[model samples]
Target: MMLPSKTVLVFSLFLLLNGILPSTTVAAARTTIGFTYSAVPSNSPSPEHVVAALQSLNIPAVRLLNPSPTLIRAFSYSNISLLLTVPNHLVTSFADNRSSATLWLYNNVLPFHPRARISLISVGADVITAAGDSGSDPTTAIVTAMQNLHHALIDLGIRTVSVSTTFSFINVITTAFPPSSAEFQEPVNSLVIKPVLEFLEETNSSLLMNVYPYNVYKLHGEIPISFALFEEGPFNFRDDVVTGVRYHNLFDMMVDSVIAAMAVSGYENVPLILTETGWPSNDEHMNVEESKMYAERYLQGLISHLKSGLGTPLRKEGAAETYIYQLFDDENESNSRRNNSLISDGDTMQQHWGVMYNNLTMKYNIHFDNADQISTVLGLLVPSMYFLWLLYDFRLAGILLVLVYFHSRKSEGLDTKITFITCQIFTSRFISGLLIDIDDYFCAFGAAKTHVSRSAFLVSTMLIFSVA
Candidate 1:
């Protein structure tokens, strides 16, 4: 006995509901949190010290500026994940020969794979550095090097590894105001950006960027410090052009700027990870207590946004992973000169920024266990909700179709009914034709024939209506 078409469709829908829906729900129940650790320079602090501090804080992942032996050794026995970096100077050498990349990985990464927990490698630091800086336009070289490195890592049987590069201040899009009008500079897009975007998309690597809202506020003093710090104060100004998008915070605006840049570059789906974002407590430019307040507020605001599980204004469904800038203040680098680097001008203020200062004392304690639990719950709920939504939509469409059929049947004898039915069928055929044309165009661009055949069926339906 064969089942009717309607019965088969219902059964197919039931199978989708039971199998595909539940699987998608389960898959969506995971969340990732990561941090960047560039402050722990090669000789400044022991990797063991850093790892111990991170472990005490319950940090699960960290990004390193360079994968030094000390750092790797320190993280060897820990479950903390590492994202290692390839410095800018070595990029050109790797680009010269792909084999060199393989050798570099063998020496730097391969040996410590499982133990060190190095999950990702950034091929080079900031491709878009200040113009006229030493070897500023290394985008092509860096991207090629990254590709080669990725291939090498894959060949070495490192399945979890990824290759990509990070960007800096120069990469922030022009016209970043209003957040919607953001786009990369024309020169950077042509020279250093397009290829890197392609490579990142191909390799499935996050677009790591060092975002500092403090600098934006410092540079443009017109914007309120309260807004920059995500304090609960009224917006400084509301945009006249895009109503309702008030200038309340710099971080959201800056993120939207990156989102806009990605949209213009046609790589909108690429993940935007905040590789560095923090404030210095003792900078000459800002007050010490204010800096600490700003840092705390900025972090709290960012974590709240991530917990909300919504994308930015421009990209409402994008990745919201963020990594705070530094674990501790380094005495080596000249922090005062560079506006970006935050250092405690005095000893006491410096101690305030670190969760565990130089004396191994914990400061400003916030429970991570509660936050992690919330993240886990969201990880489960979001995917489950999405799958259920898909099932609901499918069921709703079926019910609507049934209602439309019965309504049409009841009104068949009326003249207005005949015209309405005719118009509905006509509109359906026109839409079907358009869909068929789109499918053919996609097929021409190398879409699979299986997909194209579905388009062909839509075309056939349109032809049958046209003849009738």
Candidate 2:
């Protein structure tokens, strides 16, 4: 592996140039992204403030593992879509008695529905393998609870509120190499996952999966850091030996591995909604810079990929939504029941996944929405240095070009109009275009159906100049 600092520097430069470039395709935007608000509310942000901040961020969706009265009140009458989760313990509660699902809705959904944008009710958060689950047959319990809830929602004419569950990627997926070769291991797949897939298929709801490339990369150092951070990883590009499908990043690999598992289970077509993914701002060692960059690149590259409509190799142009794992650091320990990480309890990293300090200070220096990401204080320094180097080289080249132009004008008496046009074509059109114009990147990467999209980016920027 390359030195991490050098790799990070190169990655930042890549983002800077990528952003500065003009694109023929509609520029990538924040299309399928949301926040998984911390399960138990944090000490700060008063539930009200959390909702208010979303409004200012121009974000219209948030997922809550457990509902809060204050959150309901704040979300009520607003345009924000809420994905409320049913706790694991309650899975058996509703399973023990199906009719109780109706009561569950009355208490949770009825109070905040069309008015508060309560769009989805995730059955439970990672109940299948959650450490403390008491249910012997989690699959049966979770399915029964979902069926009951679905019936109750349909009876109440709330067809929009879909039902599903959130699952983590650790200890569940046995192998995820080459994506097409991926599959789930025994018991977990047969006992729980298969039935859940059938239920979600019947209900036409997307599966909620938690994928943390940070954890995968941290634990398995074999994976490149760039791949973990969502940067274009040359080392990660691989073609599946079995199915011949290519995968680029660990994020897509993890997601498609579940899709592969589904195919192995005799179920092949179920969409996924990423319910949790975020990097901590610090760990026991307080590595804030590395932590913040991890958050920055991972989120930025994901936003671009989704906005590009380039789904995983399995579904090239499909849809997927990713909710950042957490909104605030759980300083009060509201949702630390499962630390999933191998770190000791003393390591604050498990709880410090917020993109900022609870006080709203930019911990990752992150920007939400369509704004250019990766302009963070740390990210900007590398590009600023690279720009100076480029300026020096560019000045040297400009002097030579000027010397030739003036020599020609004085000695050869070149036609003034011809000289000016020649200069404009070279300096204004081709060179500038070379610096920041990408046409049909999909074809550039050499994917299938290249001819179909090859020329769509042909509208040379001459059109922009003429119109302006």
Question: Model 2 segments beyond 4 Å from truth?
Answer: 1-31, 39-42, 131-137, 233-236, 283-290, 332-339, 342-351, 370-468
User: Which predicted model would earn the best lDDT?
Assistant: 2
Q: What does candidate 1 score on TM?
A: 0.68
What is the total number of backbone clashes in candidate 1? 2
lDDT (10s digit) by residue, model 2, range 181-283: 6677677777777778888899898888777776677667677777766677558665678877766777778778878777877877887788887766554
Top candidate by TM-score: 2
Query: How many clashes in each structure?
Result: 2, 0
Instruction: Quote the positional error of residue 435 for candidate 1 in Å.
Output: 31
Q: What is the lDDT of candidate 1?
A: 0.62
> Candidate 2: minimum summed lDDT over ten consecutive residues — where?
436-445
lDDT of 2: 0.65
